[model samples]
Target: MVTAAFPYRLYLVIAAEACAGRDLLAVAEAAVRGGVDLVQLREKQVDEPTFLARAERLAERLSCYSVPLLINDNLRVARRVGAAGLHVGNHDLPPTQVRAQWPGVGLLGYSLEYTAQLHTPEAEAADYLGISPVFRTPTKTDTVTEWGLAGVRAIRAATPKPLVAIGNIHAGNAGPVLQAGADCLAVVSAICQAPDPERAAAVLRNQIDLYC
Candidate 1:
């Protein structure tokens, strides 16, 4: 069970390609400056070495601000970089196995692709639950459930773990998601591809403060 209150308000899920040609580190730094509290490095197309290098650099940079970095489905990189945590989906390493493998892991997140997953051991083992694709988006095509506003409300009623709502979330829609019971907002293009990541992040952060 999660022992403390969920502290993050605006979460950033970033990838090198998502930055729209800007330097990944620069974009991340700008986002943090604008109020992104938590970050996750999700590199699906990159090789292990590339992923590791990115994670290492990100871990080093984020450490300066005391912000936590969570690696998405990359246990080795996460462990090697001494990241604050790991976020895994249904196909990746299970949360129970991750706990057994890395007992000292400070935070563990599990993505709920289906509502049924909320009742599984994985959900029980997670420090937070990612309500993925709260709306369908090009970034995540493999996910099955859309988990629209109603879905978010239903999941919120069912689980007490902090909900991190992701997929196509931007400042315009952030307020309703938080009102629907999400504890945090996770975004990809909203910040990564924005004309000004800092301003984008700040806008989203303001929504969180205003709504939640």
Candidate 2:
């Protein structure tokens, strides 16, 4: 069970490719300046060495802002970089194993692809739960469920763990997602691919503050 409320209000899930040719570190730095409280480095298609290098760079950059960086499904890189946490999906490493392997990890997140996952031990072990693909989006094509607004409410009702709502989330839809019971908003293209990442992040941050 979560011992404290999840501290982050705006979570950014970023990958180098998603930045639309912009410098990943620069984009992340700007986003943090605009009020991003948490960040996750997701380098899915890269090799371990490349992923490790990127994580190392990102960890260093985020350290300056005091924003915790969560490495997505890469335990070796996470451990090597001394990341603030690790986030795993159902097909990735199990949260129970992650806990056993990295007992000192500060934050642990698990993606909820199905409501039934909430009843499992992994969900119980996570520091917070990610309600993925709250709406269908091209970024995540393999997800099993599109946990729309109703799904967010259902998950909130079932678990007290902090919920980070992801997928197709932007300023326009952020308020309703929060009202539906999400504790934080996680975004990708909305900020990464924007013409000005700082302004984009600030806009989303405002939505979170205004609605959540």
TM-score of each: 0.97, 0.97
Count the clashes in each prediction. 0, 0
Instruction: State the lDDT of candidate 1 residue by residue for 1-212, as single tens digits.
Output: 11356788899999999999999999999999999999999999999999999999999999999999999998999999999999999899999999999999988999999888988899999999999999999989989999999999999999889999998999889989888989999999999999999999999988788876
Kindly give the stretch of ten consecutive residues in candidate 1 with the minimal lDDT sum.
1-10
lDDT of 2 by residue, 5-40 (tens): 687889999999999999999999999999899999
Residue pairs in clash, model 1: none
Backbone clash pairs for candidate 2 read none
On a 0 to 1 TM-score scale, where does candidate 2 land against the true structure? Answer: 0.97
lDDT of 1 at 111: 93
Instruction: Give the alpha-carbon lDDT of every model.
Output: 0.92, 0.93
Q: Please, what's the RMSD in Å of model 2?
A: 1.7
